[model samples]
Target: MRSLTEQDIRSSFVNCSKGEAKRLAIPRDLDERPWADLDFLGWRDPGAPDRSYLVTERAGRLVGIALRFPSSQRGFLHRSMCSLCLTTHPGNGVSLMTARKAGAAGREGNSVGIYMCTDLACPLYIRGKKVPEAGGRFEETLTTEQQLARMTDNLSAFLDKLHA
Candidate 1:
C-alpha cells in the first residue's frame, strides 16, 4: 500500500456521489498510518458512527467504497471472525460492514455485507502489529505473506461484488 492524500481518497470513491465523497471523512492522521502494513485503508466516520469507508489499490487503480453498519450494539458482545483476514476478536472488535453497490445497482438499493475488523485493521492483526482480545491469532502453517495473499484475495472478491 502507498500513502494516500486527501484528494486521492476523496476522488477514489466509486459507489457514492461526488458531493458525498467530498464531504466524507478521510482520516486526520494519514501521515501516521502504517502504510506498509495496510492492504486497504478503512475507517469509521467519527461524526456518524454507523458510517465507514474503505479504499484500496485494486486492478492497478485506487477504488473506494462507503460502508455502513448497524448502529445498535446487537452483535458486538461475542467473539467473531473477520471474513477478510480470518482473525478472530472478542466483543466489539468485529462488525458487519456493508457497502452499497456501484452504479445503478446502488441507486436501486443493492448492497453487500461482510464481517470485518471494526477498526479496519486486518493487516495489523495478521502481522501482530495489533492483537485481538481473543488471545491473538490462531497458530497456522501459513507464512505472513501467505496470510496476506489470502486477505487480498478476500478483499478483491468483495470489491468484485460491488462492481458486479
Candidate 2:
C-alpha cells in the first residue's frame, strides 16, 4: 500500500457523499503509518464511535467505504474470527460492520455488512506484527504471503459487492 494524504483519503470514498467524507476524521498519523505492510487503511472515527472507514487501491485507483457498527462491547469469553485475516479473537474484538452501497443504491439505503476485526488491524495480525489479546493460534499450512494474499482477495471481494 502507498502512503495517502488527507485529501487523497477524502476523495477516495465511494459510499458516502463528498461533503460527508470531507467532514469525517482522517488519521493524524498518515505519515507515520506502516504503508509497506498495509493492504488497506482502516480506522474508526474518533469523533463518532459508531463509524469507521476503510480505503484501498482497487484497479489503478483508490476506493474507500464508510462503515457503521454498534459501539457496545461484546463478552470477552466468546471466540470469533475476523472474516478478513482469519484471526481469532475474543468476541469483543470483532464486530459486524456495514457499509452503504455506492451511488444510487446507497441513496436508496442499501448496504453490505461483514464481521471484521473491531480495530480493523487485519493486515498487522496476519503479518505477526500485532497480536490480539485472545491470542489467535492457527495450525495452518499456508505461509504468511499466502495468508496475506487471501486477506487482500477477501477485502477486494467485499469492495466489489459494495460497487455491485
Which candidate number would show the highest lDDT if scored against the true structure? 2
The digit string of per-residue lDDT tens for model 2 on 74-160 reads 777888888999888996788889999999999999999988998999999988899888659486799999999999999988988
| Window of ten residues with lowest summed lDDT in model 1 | 70-79
Q: Please, what is the whole-model Cα lDDT of each candidate in the order they appear?
A: 0.90, 0.91
* Model 1 TM-score on a 0 to 1 scale: 0.95
Q: Pick the TM-score winner.
A: 2
lDDT of 1 at 75: 50
Candidate 2 accuracy as lDDT? 0.91
**Candidate 1: where are CA atoms >4 Å away?**
74-77
Task: Name the weakest run of 10 consecutive residues (lDDT summed) in model 2.
Answer: 131-140
Off by over 4 Å in 2: none
